[model samples]
Target: MTRKTILSAVGLVIASFAVLTALNYATAKRLYHSLTLFNESVIVENFSNMSDIFETVEIEKTAPEHKFGQAYQPLPKTYLYKGEKRDTENFLEKTSTTALVVIRNNDIMFENYYRGTTESDRRISWSTAKSFLSAIFGVAVAEGHIASLQDPVTQYVPELKGSGYDGVSIKNVLQMSSGVRFDEDYGRFNSDINRFGRTMALGGSFDDFAASLEKEREQGEYLHYVSIDTHVLGMVLRNATGREIADYFNEKLWSQIGAEDSALYIVDSYNEPMVLGGLNLRTRDYARFGKLFLDNGQWNGKQIIPAKWVTESTTPDAPHLKPGKRDSSDINLGYGYQWWIPENADQEFMAIGIYDQYIYVNQKAGVVIVKNSANINFMDNGFESATETVEVFRSIVATL
Candidate 1:
């Protein structure tokens, strides 16, 4: 109880924290150096294995439906990538594709698995999971839970009182134009995105980390890809609905969609769902999600998502998200509510993720393609890139 003893205890605690921080930094740097562990093997295990770093909330199983006619009919033999035509076989090999499934009008046109994966594997959706959250938001809006997309995020999530999101609207977050300063390079250990990952790994809170962000630009001024923006959106949605995300997902969309197996979401130490990219579902189930959007939020006979919400969600009306350079398409892209639009495309949008995961919806062709990969070199430019994967999806749809 002496003053000397109290000072000693405080110093010891500080020293322990410093040592743990140094160790975590070293581990992150070392892990980033290995492609096999950081990219390939970890991705394979992310689906089949996820207990060490995550606490999961189960998505209740859905009643199955005989929705698809048959699978693996035939696909385009060749596809063009980076201005060169290549065979489908080579493209899959080069991209490190783990699973590929093509669904045309509710019938499987092609399906295949590689890299020790099977049809039943509950693959992680990565950022592609953002679209799933977007879907739930749409239903929330229609039900009057979230008054409007134009509402500021802090209106519902008061915990973000004075952070970068203090003045950002839900629409800006959905469009990824929150103007928060964040570096998303997965290969960089010290980058903001990686630091966020480290926070989760070390039992830090996603919301607290997000609320700590500083403003990089005026709200809605730029179209930078800030993953934490989606987390804020999820935070608002959860607060408004007053339900666990997994339970709400089951009630509103998943259970009605006829998912063959239970889907899963990775939660943080506080048990809050990682709404930015924690969704894990089967390949066919991903296709079913795409079909829901294609149907304009209709499934079988029910309007699962609001028709108006569906239309507005895909339609990028904001000036920062229009299909033009001034609208931020120097990368040959525009963005929707939570979707991506290719340069000069007609009625086509996609859900994409890092480490090469996608749900490509070509509504014009009535086709949906779900491709998942563990490509460590996804950041590599030239032929093997996310853009080229879109090209491959386009080529396949063209052949159909």
Candidate 2:
């Protein structure tokens, strides 16, 4: 080859190398942002903007929306915390709360947004999405799509057979007692939950991640807070009904309930809804769900979810699932199918998510309170953030 031709070939190779390097840099930057999305500095923005950072499937909003009535009220000035009263507003600020909505008698009593968020922002639901899934699962059961809760989960999702989920009853999985040995400590970089987050960031299969777990104990013997158990329910729902979770959810729950806006679920590489904790919606919509359960699955005189299933899901049947501390259980709060019965309860329960998200319902008081937070200190002091938030809700209810 001539000298000029050789130089031209070298230039072409140099250009190709530069383009490859730039692409790699861009990928690395994206991966870093995904991994650090929850950092204290950016968590507030990140929580409300999850769709921009991850793959999401939209749950379309339905027409003739069920809107809330306005009866605006002020929150209580003080709330009890560890037997000491603290300023309620200060507490909210301390916890990094982004949005709060209080509803009673199907009306919005108080609503506020913080940290540059608004009513339109679709806040991440985190694990609270499990409760939403539980509602839809009830629909499947009522429609006879699922034969029985006593049946093994593998009967629906045969892919889970030979894995940790094999032979585990659908009921046990619903109750979060699947006996799967999976570490959910988000503070640990190498914990299973963090690994799962990484998998989402890198486009891995959530189904495969769940199937790779190992059984730690016998099913239904104890109460274990396994996040993956919810995902298994999603799988069972999909297989039993032969439909995608998002589509089914829209048809049965989202559309039927009259959502104000389209919500989203962060999906995996295969477009599977991360039902364990990937739902996103406005704070008011969360309260709407809480209201649905508060009214025993009725919305505007229509039976959206089976009333019997609501009763069954919120009531802990087994001793291991009862509140106020137990050797067999991992938490002091009582466990139902996918709901939480707080200690010293007076017909109250809640759906909780990581980083301080809560949809608390008080039946006796006819109250529903939704709180969304970006609390980086959520795990500090043995989760006092969550325990205290319960007290805060109670105080507000008393005032209402």
Q: Judged by TM-score, which candidate is best?
A: 2
In angstroms, the error of model 2 at 282 is: 0.8
RMSD of 2: 2.7
| Candidate with the greatest lDDT versus the true structure | 2
Once fitted onto the true fold, the runs of candidate 2 whose alpha carbons sit more than 4 angstroms away are: 1-30
TM-scores, all models, native as reference: 0.88, 0.94
Name every residue pair that clashes in candidate 2: none
Give lDDT: candidate 1, residue 348.
88
Can you tell me which runs of candidate 1 are displaced by over 4 Å? 1-42, 324-330, 382-384
Instruction: Summarize candidate 1's per-residue lDDT along 1-400 as a digit string, tens digits.
Output: 9999999999999999999899877546434432233555466765555533355788868677547877566777888766777788887887778899998888899899988889988887889999999998889888899987789999999999788888788988998889888988888879988888766665668889999998888877678898988899889988999987888888999988888888888877788888898888888889999999888899998999987877777887777787656745234567888888876778888898887889888888999999988776788863247677778888888877
Clashes per prediction? 0, 0
